[model samples]
Target: MLIPSELVLSILSYCDGSTLATCQQVCRHWQTLIDHYDALVWSPCCERDFQKGLRRRFWSLDFPDPQMVDAAMLSSYAKPSTLWQSLYRITKHWSLGQCTTSFLTNYTLRQQKRRPCVVVGTTQEYNFFTSLSVAQSGHIVRSNPMYKGTTEGRQAMIVHASFDQDPTLSSFYLEDDALHGIVCHYSHPASPWIVTGGLDGTVSLWNEPERCVARTWQGHRGRVLCVSMNDQVVISGGSDSMIRVWDLDDAEQRGSIDISSYLSERHDWFQGVGEIALNGHLIVCAPDTSGPVLIFSLLTGSLVYELKTEPQDVAFTRLCLTPFYLLTKGEINPSNRNQVPIYPNTSSSSTPTVSSSPYSNTTNSGSSSLSSLSSLSSSTSTAISTYALAPPPSLSLTPYQLSRYYNLSSNNMTTFTAARSCIDVWDLQTGKLVYRLVPPLPATTTASITDIRISPNAAHVFACVEIRDNGSRRNELCYWDFSNHHTAAPSIMVLPSMTSSSFGNAWACFY
Candidate 1:
């Protein structure tokens, strides 16, 4: 005799999360009831678990409230039961340090006309890419190292592939021989536009759908170091210590800012624009490794603010800017507090180019050593003051409300840490330390982070980490999921060809 579906669901509803999971595997009838009516069965389970102890203390303000989602704003995008269940599972997995990894693909060097240098112990071979971009659709595009050529041709190329698949050899090449090679590039997350900055100081926009150059512009007197763009504007920082703004539509020059003029002294020939982040309105630029980051108005080409970092934490190679906060990766000095000092340009009118650095360039008072971490922790850190940058009208919230909405308390500040293997999140509104995120790695191995990328909502952070274990080195692509997206898939399919090396020798890791 079989039990009635209603009666079975009622009985299952009384069960805990673990018991409910077990019931689904007992028989097809129970599985059907549970899977079809997941909302009814799992919603309560998630709430119960979350209330008891599954809260993530990340910077997000939407904690303990099972109804509010910090990542996706659309209610139609995620079903209630599914979202709750996914949240429960992901939180449990992250907190308990549980995840499965698999090797995807590795790169090999092809035979070249010039003598090739032999690579040793996965260090040089694995660090092949200089810059990479990821889209919302899971497509990853990588700019190749600026070298002479492969067997293909003298011009440099950019490789495109999906996150789960191997990179295809078919790529867009910089055809102009005058532009010695490609240095940096940016790809729109949703659109078909791709912009590349070349050694010859040329920026070319490529239309992926048409697979041809849409437009080109040349202004930089030296090699372009970094490039970033939106749909309307393209910003390029070059080795000439000049940052140029271009209109994406007609390829006309919008404005230019010389980095050297603002600095205290002249920069070395090797020290040029190293990183740039653009959001159409503002351009955050770093000229050299150690930085007093300069912010420029994209439209007027005038200096807006100057952000100074402690000497220990000023080796700025990466820059990510949101509407309110600026994130840079550098050497981390872990102290009781990890606050970023923001200095407003008090002399913007009288001396627009003068740096407003708080600390003297000679004094290293802020320098501190990094502490070791056995596991991820939410321990508190230092504090700083917040600047009132208005939240976008789209959010429809004031700076105070925005801070409270994001659970930033009353500090109105944001804080971040830059340990090699760890990343931190700050509340720009409150000027307080929010979250310190570290990827789950084995306690026995030593790991170093190569790159870190944060989603626009600050809900997800992706880390590309290389770990050394028992004399062998391997890479891992790890992400911290704060949203209830399509995480619980039926099964994972590993590509057969992805297991083998396409170029020379391959190294692979699970996603």
Candidate 2:
């Protein structure tokens, strides 16, 4: 016999995939329940017809989904029916192979001929957006999500940005140096950053970059390969063969001795310094293949430990500290597939002209080596302190290795090893290797793991393999949930098409 209706309704509420579809067609009451429940509780994109129903019945104001309309119609007066317009405006022109989440104050590069600097914010009533960061060129703009045709609705706002305040400009301790591309951390929402890796091979620190430089650090000599900071301190690595650490509070040299000065003078280029993690006594750096990250004794600047990489042409490409600061939020718009991420771009609602970078000029300076640490001196350290010694290089390992963090889930850990396509996974707590979760493809499938990226929230991790179809380079993403990873393999999720600018790539935010 068929199940009772109330019991079935209760069970169906939690049902998903095809099972729920089958239940809905069982009876008249079942159909009504399915339709009504879908519109009210299920996600807005769940029903095919419900979205069409929204435009005619709900949004008296006109809004259209950018995905459905051409660019010509995006600015046209023809408004979509109410139900879907709001959702459509929130999510349009999202792209694949990119990941996004709710970490507030991030900039979303919306549709534009050039890379557009778009600000995203939130408020109780609706979302707010200004014109794209205008350059010398004319400005491109999107209608305020809450822009009411009437004056009354104009005042009613929903989404809003954090940096509406007029921040006073100030000079920084850092000097005017050549700049590589900018990499910033918006983690400390109150005190954001514009950490620049310099061409003169120095690192400069800027406070929330509205109008001034907060602090400048003149440390590295070669191109500053990477820079990452957190609540506790500012860390930088460069081609100068050193990774320096600075105190965040007053930008003081941490610990008793200034390790920042002692080590940077030793190597030729510290190239890719991977993510950094400060664990009580150990300051760790995971870097590209150049050398082992100098884990100095934060207490003495003495090299305490080393996180070695597989010996290869590896400098760290990206380095995040131990704490995975997850910026997460829900995707309100289905087609958009990503919520507007927050960026702490502090400027005059204007985009700055970006160039190929200062390092582009110095990259060909040729390989040069330093003499010795005989002159390496900490103002606080006497010659006796200089003799204390650096960490002895790795025992059997070759010069430094090319080790990259391949995949990290809430449930598993994976790393790229020496064997080209090989990646290893381990248990998060025990550090015991979890061999089952490794990539199932043959070792010959990929040239390298350059396309691997983990979602900021750690819910999903994606890796794009270097496989080719015809003459075109075609890579596919393998997505696995952080929670169920130990028992699960990633399902392959791909871009619908090259032209598909659907919200952030193969990942979604959930918090």
Give the candidate number with the greatest TM-score: 1
State the C-alpha lDDT per candidate: 0.48, 0.31
As a TM-score, model 1 comes out at: 0.53
User: So what's the TM-score on candidate 2?
Assistant: 0.37
How well is each residue in 1-511 modelled by candidate 1, as lDDT tens digits? Answer: 9788999998877665556656766898887777678668877665554334322233211212334333232222244445544444444332222222222233322222111111111122233433455433234445555434454566554443332233433344434344546777787444568788987899888765565678889999988988888768888999898998888888689888898888764233236787888764567787654446777766677776676544432344456654334555433334422453221111223111112211112112231111111111122112212211111111112233234325433343233212233443333323233333444444444555555555443333445556655766555555544432433211112112211232122121112
Per-residue lDDT of model 2, residues 84-106, tens digit only = 22222122101000111111112
The runs of at least 3 residues in candidate 1 whose Cα sits more than 4 Å from the true structure, single-residue gaps closed, are: 1-130, 134-139, 145-154, 163-180, 266-270, 330-421, 424-435, 441-445, 456-458, 469-472, 484-511
Task: RMSD for all candidates, in order, please.
Answer: 17.2, 24.2
Task: Estimate the TM-score of every prediction.
Answer: 0.53, 0.37
**What are the runs in model 2 whose C-alpha is more than 4 Å off?**
1-191, 208-212, 255-282, 286-444, 451-457, 485-511
* lDDT of candidate model 2 versus the reference: 0.31
